[model samples]
Target chain A: MEVLAHGLGGRTDLPLDAVAAIVGGGAAVAASFLALTVAWRRPRLRPEGGRPVPARIARALDSPALTWAGRTVALAAAVFVVVVALAGPGGEKANLAPWALYVTFWVGLVPASVLLGPVWRRVNPLRTLHDGLCRITRADPAGRWPIPKRLGYWPAAAWLTGFVWLELVAPHRSDPRLVGVLIIAYGAVNLALARVCGRDWFTRGDGFEAYSNLLARMCPVGRRGDGTLVLRTPLTGLMRVTGEPGLVAAACVLIGSTGFDGITRTTYWRDNVDPGSLSAGTLGLAAAIGVVTVLYLAGMRVSAALTGEAAGELPGRFAATLLPIALGYTVAHYFSFFVLEGQMTFILASDPFGTGLNLLGSTGHRIDYDLAGPTLTAQVQVNAIVLGHIAATIAAHDLALRTQPAHRTVRGQLPIAVVMVALTCAGLFALLSG
Target chain B: MRGVRLRTVVMAVAIGVAVTLAGCGEPAAPSGGTGGSGGTSGTGTAKSAPATFTGPSRKPDVTVVSATVSRGKVEIAQNGVNAQGRVKVRRGATVRITVTTDEADEFHLHGYDRTLKLSPGRPGTLDVVADKTGVFEAELHHSGARVFELQVS
Candidate 1:
């Protein structure tokens, strides 16, 4: 009922076998790049060729009634969780707040966005709350000051770093009372900021919004420039990500924090370098993010040297390629917990306040850990990491050719390919050895 | 014409990786103490991969392990000097863990939800069957200090 101390979900994933899996993952990444060099001679994915979805389906999706309904339901869910978390039973088992936030909402966003394309933007409760406040007060949605030109996505990146730290390193993070206070404080701050910065601020400032939108770049379903719902190659969606300010920072934070999370669970870190205090944990998380940021910049610098491109802009230019890898790391790390804890949340939601009443009647069902056995899970994890690397390599290679002449494309991508292999191997080794 | 060839290359890469994934070991079920040898296997899973799932073995071989809590630190039995935060046991084996604490606390094995109340001098025992394969943390509830994770595979 209390689950584990550091976070939710009592049973953590089994460590991967050390030798074979890491070697396989690294070699697979290397082989994919090498194979791509010989055959994938030029950029192929059509970024402008999204076949428009049928008009009727697009109209249904665009319907204002559906949009309002979605926003209303999402707001209601948020309020319900907040109320129960604040006033409900203290036990995590009886309280649905922490589970809903961590498993059902946060981890669930990955797959949901991958499949449905940034559903959070459509259903964000904060946006609705802000709109309601504005309409009631008859205040202009657009504020007096323009959001600074240099600000770009830096706010989003900072919010993301803050959120990951809370999820991964914050002490007593799983407690419902703490969760309630934090979410309320977080919502209030964001709402206040939105009121000052205007409606468009949420697009580049809210952490969850940016997180979902980043991942949605990998979704096959997307809207064209004209707002028509269109179906495109998933890679094309990824290829279209522009190198906006803080784009690299956001990507690095995502990949690095995930990498840090994998490292924390390893036996080597726990036994050898166990940081005793919260300050130590905060430092470790920062160090992990810093390591990833430096490695990525170094890779881009080398890419510039080889391609004869300007060194200053290469990191931003290639930042879009990291999205697939980030998604892969996310899936590899959180999917199993999502499946197991998601069911637990469903059952707990049936009794939001630990009252005897089972609202959804799901409390009668049991949480089945057998949904994924160890062997099956390990294979999936390994495959997810390896597949992510291959996709990244493909994206990088395509972008290289598209950005410049084909003559130096393969050579320019070689350094990045090496970097990808190193990241993939380090990730696998850390996960397995732990 | 080029698109078809490029797709072929991607397919080849995917198939090659799938083969590698298949070669990766299952970590458990193989070379584990499934033969009822009663601790003879002793973590020697370095041998050939049988790739076979052995049937249900003899009675749950209960391993008696203990931990002592003092000076606000937990010292697990036989896992000192280089503790990996857990004791490894093959799935299907039963473990009977005993703990003595300087503080009044309750021993909780999560996932299994097995709990035992502990007094300052009096020890408590939690008997668990490692039927599920994963790492479950065991902790002292009141102090919230971990008493070694149970790594069942």
Candidate 2:
């Protein structure tokens, strides 16, 4: 009668040698900033510069049939999960729906987007459903009303927060019926919004879509103005990101959620924070997000003042630089879960309804817990967090060079660089301590 | 050019230092439990009292056994009265855990892969030799409630 816990469970990492890892990470960031200030004079990450993919390949990727196929596969998977969630046994071991959503989809999106670009946009079932309905009705895919410009990505940010709360804090997160209901509610709400707002709803309104798109900015494979596939530097793609409203909130939600995930696993959190009460968990999640947002805002304000830019506009302007940091935390926190539980997804898929049907021939699969030992896991976590901060520091420095005068560039970036170091240290500490 | 070269050298030195520091901070290897601490030190330490068997049978050393459940909440005795954070024991120690619940449920100890069926008012016992050194989860299978973390140093 042994069963896996609701969340990914294993030996948590031993507490990091905090003094060494944090100080080292901080020093590296500071040194990089100083070197960049002196040695790097020009802005190198220009968005318009990229080598286009060969014409044949680009055309094949752009084909409407390919897009439809992707949408179909995504829709079919969603429908399967929904069916199983409704009828499958309530236990986590007996259900494939939770594994598919949490491990395969949520954690899998990081590497998938990084390698293949924004796959979710092409494969989002709700968007496909909306488009199909529109075609059937003889209406334009773009809805009657345009989404308000001021609304921007705020709804997506709110939705992202709500999703994290459900995944990390909700008592019934592993309950199949609850998950199924939430999925249906999420899809229905987004589909209705898309009806009024058109295709733009998926880009700036859907939480998962926005999350995928943001991470995709770090992907080297992108499209040009003519929809031709191109190979570009990740930095170039990141630089092209526009300062959209609510971008800061969205980024903070990502950073904060991952931070809280790490903290919730620690002995301190487990012992002090009552497991039965949702209040402590909710407050902790909010506090983590708040701290990240406040620190980011402070850095932006300082940089803005130094560069003679508008303080009010700094948050959105600097938001894209934090994407790498978010990506780093994500990779560090979810790497093991993705590796271990991701295998379980295949096993569960074989008998999704718990009727013992071995459809995929994966029923014999066994999860190898020793695939990643504690030492290796700790090393990877530290490296990811540190490397991500380094990437963010470089991006911020380059952005400062682009925005400020030659004399002011270094001054403007100093505060932001320090903030990046602090954030890196914080991320490292959380991983190690947790 | 001089400033560029100087900055390059400095950056290289800083990176070297960072890498060196990281390498120096490799975590200590998991060791046999011996230290006495009332609470978990976030690492290996036997924090529980030596077990006392009431029966005529003299068995191996039992660190801590028996946990009570009421209204879906689990309570284990640390010093001997109330349940708390974790039950820490030395490696190779024989640990027998008995769980009594208000409802019939499956009790599972993760990592060790031990399971028991607990009937209402009847205590179910799971005996295991703590040969492995790590923290394993003790949980109620049906309710998915974690009873406590078992740390075997």
Which candidate number has the best lDDT? 1
Steric clash pairs (candidate 2): B76-B83
- Cα deviation of B134, candidate 2, in Å: 7.3
lDDT of each: 0.75, 0.73
Worst 10 residues of 2 chain A by lDDT: A1-10
Candidate 1: tens digits of C-alpha lDDT, residues A334-413: 76676666666667777677767767676534455666678766866787788877888888888887886678888888
For every model shown, what is its TM-score relative to the native structure? 0.88, 0.82
TM-score of 1: 0.88
Q: Which run of 10 residues does model 1 chain A get worst, by summed lDDT? A: A1-10
Place model 1 in a CAPRI quality band: incorrect
Q: Give the Cα-based TM-score of candidate 2 against the true structure.
A: 0.82
Instruction: Name every residue pair that clashes in candidate 1.
Output: A266-A434, A267-A434
Residue by residue across A1-434, what tens digits does model 2's lDDT show? Answer: 22222244433434567788888888877888888888888988777778998889888987899998999999999998888888887866668788788877887777777667899998999888898889888877788899889888899899999988877777767777777888899999998888887988899899999989988887778876666688877756677434889888999999998998788766777777765457987898999999999999999899889889888876887798889889888877776566555666677787787777878676534444444455655666776787778778878788777777788888888889879988988887876663
